[model samples]
Target: MTNPQLLWLRKNLFNTWYNSLLTIICIAFLIWLAKSIIIWTTTQAQWTVVQVNLRLFLVGRFPQSLYWRVWIVLAIASTLTAITWGVFSSKQHLTKRQIAVYTFIIAGFLMGLPGDLTSRSWLLLISILLAIGFGIGRKFPKIILPWLSLTWLLSFSLIIWLIGGGLGWQSVSTNSWNGLLLTLLMAAVSIVLSFPIGVLLALGRTSNLPIIRWFSILYIEIIRGLPLIGILFLAQVMLPLFLPVDLRLDRVVRAITGLVLFSAAYMAENVRGGLQAVWRGQVEAAKALGLNSLLVTILIILPQALRAVIPAIVGQFIGLFKDTSLLSLVGLVELTGISRSILAQPQFIGRYAEVYLFIGSIYWVFCYSMSLASRRLEKQISQ
Candidate 1:
C-alpha cells in the first residue's frame, strides 16, 4: 500500500527542487524556534509572577469579598456562550478532539492559579452551567432563538448593574474597575453602542438629503483622520472643559466614549461598503412591489447589506476589542496596563517577557475566539 503521509509530503513539500529546498530550510527554522521557546519556558521563566498576581491581573483592585458578583457575571456569560454555540453548531457533534482540547485548557487553568477550593468550585460550577445551557439550547433551539436577543440585552444590563453596583447595593466607584474586567466592559459597551451609530451614519452618508449626507461624511472623515490615542486624550482632557465641573464623567466612561467614537467611524465605513454592495435591482424590485422607501430599506436593503458585510463588521469589532489596550496609556488599568503594574513589583521587576507573554496569550485567546465565531456565523448564514 502507498503511504498517504509520504505521498502528501512528496506532492507538496518535495514537488520541485526549489520547493523541496525551501521546505527543508523552513522546517529547520521552525524546529530551532520551537526548541528555543521550550527551553526558555521550562527552564528560564519564573512563572511565580503570573501565578501569584493572577487575581490582580484578572480583576485589579476589586474587593476579594465581592468576588462572588464577578463569578455570577462569569457564569451568566458562559451559559449564554454555550447556548449560542449550541444554536449555531446544532448540526455539528462535539468531537473527541474538541473535548480533549477543552479538558486540557480547563486542567491547565486549574493547575496554574494558586486559588483555594472556593475559586476552583466556582469555576467547576460555571463549567457545568455552561454545559446545561448548551443542552437546553440544542434541545429547544426554535423556542430559544426568538428570545435570544432580548435575553442578551437583559443579561448585559444585569452584568453592568452588578459590576457597577448601584440602586441598592454599595456603589463601587468606576475607578476601582480595572484589569480584564474594565477591558471587557469597555469593549462590550463600545461595540454595542458603536454598531447602531455606525449603521445610522452609513445610512445618512447614503441618504438622498445633501445636508445629512454631507454631515455624515464630515463626521466619519474627521473621526477616521484622527488617531485613536488623540481622541482618547481629547475625551480625557478636553471633554471636562466642555462639561460643568459638577458633571464629571468617570475616567472609564471617558475611555469608553472615546473608543465608541473612534470605532464607530471605522464601523460606518465598513457598513457603508456593505450598503453600497446591495444591488440597485433589489431596490427597484421592492419599489415595484409598492414598498415605501423606509419599508424597502428596513425589510430588503439593510438586512442584505449587513449580511454581506458580516466579515468586515466583525473584523472591525475585533480591532475595537484589541484597541482597549490603549486605555492604559490614558491611565486606565486594562489588561496591558495591569501587566505593566505587575512588572513594576520588586520581585517581578525583570520579568517583562513573562508578564507580556501571559498578557499576549489572553489577547490571542479572545481575538482568536472572535475570529472563530465570525467564521462560524458566516458559515451558518451562507447555509
Candidate 2:
C-alpha cells in the first residue's frame, strides 16, 4: 500500500485500540466504585428495615384480594402489547443496543437489592409478557391488528366485569394507586381519549362555519391558557359540583378526564398545524376530481396531515406522560406521588435522596425513550 493507505490503516487500528482500552478502563472503574459505595452504604446505613417494607413502597396499601386484578390487568396489557406488535410488525425492528438496554432494565428490576417486600411474581409476569410480546411482534407482524383489537376488547370487558361484580373500585382507590401502574394508566387513557377529541377540535377549528370555528377556538384557547394544575383543580374540585348528586366521580377518573381535556387542546393545535401544512392545491385537486369535501379531507388530506404531525403528537404524549405526575398534587398516587408518600413514612425519612433518584431514573427512562422515538419518526418522515 502507498504511504497514505498505510497512514489510514494505522489511524483505524489506533482508533479501535483507543476505544477498547477506554471501555475496559471505564468498566473497571465503575465496578470498583460501585463495590466501594455498596460497602460503605451497607456498613453505615440501616437498609434492612427499608428492605422489609419495599412492598409498601412498590404497591402501597393495595388490598391483597385485588392483587389478582393487578396481575390480570398486566396479562391483558401483555396481550395488548402482542396485538400492537402484530399490527405494526412491518414497522418494528429493534437494534442490539435497544435489546441490551431492555435486558439491563429487566435485570435491575429483578436483582436490585430493593426492600425485601418486593413483588417478584409481578416482575416475573411482566418479564414473561414482554418476552412473549416481543417474540410475537418479531415473528407474526401480520396478525398484530386483530390481536391488538382482541386484547383491547378483552381488557375493556375485564374492566367492566371488575366494576360490575361489586368488586368495588375502592379496592384500588385513587389515593392508594401508585407506582408504574398509575403512570401507565394515566398515559394510556390520556392518549386514547385525547386523539378523537383532538381530531374533532382540529376539524372544527378549520371549518368554514363561523360558529364551529368560534367554539373550537374558544375551547382550545381557554383550555390552553390555563395551567395544567388549574385544570386539574377544576377537575378535582369544581367539576364534581356540576355532576348530579348521585353521580360521584372517582379522583382517578377526574384526573384522567382533566389530563385528556388538557392534552386534547395541545393535540388539536398539532393536528391543526398538520392540516394547515397540507397544500391547498391538493384539496383543490380532490375537489376537481369530484370528491366531496368530507371525503377529500378524510381520505386525501387527514392521513398525510396525521403522518406529518406524528412527531408533534408524540411530543405531546411524552409531555402528557410526565404531566401525569402532577396528579400527585391532587392526592392521586402516581409514581412521583408514591415516591413522595414513601419518603413521608417515619422509617423512610431522610431517604428522599435514594427514592427521588430512583423515581427520576424511571421517569427519565420513559421520557427519553419517547423523545428518541419521536426523533426517529421525524427522521423517517423527513426521509
Highest-scoring model, lDDT: 1
lDDT of 1 by residue, 1-383 (tens): 47998999999999999999999999999999999999999999999999999998999998888899999999999899989877887766787688557756765665455789999888888767766787787778888888998999899999999988999997787778889999899999999999999999999999999999999999999999999999999999998898988998989888888999999899999989988999999999989999999999899889999999988999999899999999999999999999988988998899998999998998889989999998888888888
Give the alpha-carbon lDDT of every model. 0.89, 0.76
Screening candidate 1 with a backbone cut-off below 3 angstroms (N, C-alpha, C), the clashing residue pairs are none
Model 1 C-alpha lDDT versus the unseen true structure: 0.89
Cα lDDT, model 1, residue 57: 90
User: Which portions of model 2 miss their true places by more than 4 Å?
Assistant: 1-53, 82-126, 146-175, 372-383
In order, what is each prediction's RMSD in angstroms? 1.9, 6.0
